[model samples]
Target: MADYNRWMNERLYDAAATLPEAALFEDRGAFFGSLFATLGHIVAADLIWLNRFVQLPALAELRGPLSALPAPTGLRDRVADSLPMLRERRVQTDVVICDMVRRLEPVHFDEVVRYGNTAGASQAKRFGPLLQHFFNHQTHHRGQASTLLFQAGVDVGVTDLNALIPHEA
Candidate 1:
């Protein structure tokens, strides 16, 4: 998992690094009219999930001037900041998940995880499902970014999880 994550993380940054500010902020018909907005959403979502696992400040609770990365230059710098945060969150949450997995003798994958939902309402869902949602959410948005990158002529290579894994020793 670590090696695979490391490889993908490196790829993400490499792809991000190649993009020009103009391309990064181009309105390619993404959710918010720009690739930069879509990338911001991805970073924000990662932070939200991290908050759920590690008791960090909720992304929703972050009230301040939102840094507008409306240009490819600004977007790339934001991506630079976001990649490390995503990596740190992944490592920290993975530790918590590993501990949870190890401690359970008869694991209840259906155990509920309570949190506030998107509409600002409190909610609960099975842990297994939520974890699945977290990774799936990441993949979904990353694909959006990848598509945008391709449209901008940046080749974001090999995103498949299978390719991320190491061969058996």
Candidate 2:
């Protein structure tokens, strides 16, 4: 799972890195404005989920959708601006999840986690399924962002989960 996460992150970064400032801002009809806003949404969602997993104060207000579109930044700018925060938060989230999994002698797969639904309705749901959805949600949106970037003439690198290796060679 760690390898999968790391790989997905790298592929996401690689795809993001290839996007030119011009293409990044070009409206591809993606939510937010262009590829840039979509990417921003992905980053924002990841941050929110990680914050909850790590028990950190919510960094930004929990909103259903992005409001002010984030401007396109260069590859370097994105690396400098978002990667560090995302990576750090990801590590913290992974650690907490691993610890929780370790502590659970046997978890009930059917057990649900209660939370406020998007419609502001109260709900209870299974845990493992929700976790799966959380990760899958990232992949789904990132895939859209990647496609938008490609349409805009950028090349996001290999996206397979099996392709990501640890940072250490």
Candidate 3:
């Protein structure tokens, strides 16, 4: 899933780069209002979740790097106002996610993750499900961003998950 996240972001950004600078940030009446804001939201939310994940002992190695990414106070908070900065953060965060999944143990999956939501509500859930939610959240918003791109006359080709699946030898 980490690979999928990175792959999709790369494709999306590449496609987005083709758009005129004004259209890239123009309000399209979407959930986040524009492609830039949507992308920024993804990075911000990702850093938020990574902040929580790094609190776990198993993911301690992630602490140092993730600390460099700003912790978004709210989901809509802009993590990067420029496309280049946003893309850089996305690449960095994806690397941390790949590192995190590589280090997961069976025990870590079932362990409860306790963290506050952006709403400041208390929460406790198993790490496995929380991790699932984290990835799902990305896909959901990415889909929206893709649609926004499409509406603006850009087509992101081959978004199916199967595109990333490896064939057995």
lDDT of candidates 1 onward, in order: 0.55, 0.53, 0.91
lDDT tens digits by residue: candidate 3, 35-98? 9999999999999998888888999888998888888879999888778888898899899999
lDDT of 3: 0.91
Residues 1-169 of candidate 2: C-alpha lDDT, one tens digit per residue: 5446545656665665565656666777766666655655555554444333322122123221222222222211231134445445445444444444444323544565665544566767665676677678778877887787677666776777755554675
Query: How much is the lDDT of residue 92 in candidate 3?
Result: 91
Tens digit of lDDT per residue, candidate 1, span 8-38?
Answer: 5456556865777666667888875666667
Worst 10 residues of 2 by lDDT: 63-72
Provide the TM-score for each candidate, comma-separated: 0.64, 0.60, 0.97
Best lDDT among the predictions, by candidate number: 3
Give the per-residue Cα lDDT of candidate 2 at 78.
Answer: 38
Using TM-score as the measure, name the better of candidate 2 and candidate 3. Answer: 3
Q: Which pairs of residues collide in model 2? A: 15-156, 112-125
Alpha-carbon error at 46 in model 3, in Å? 0.6
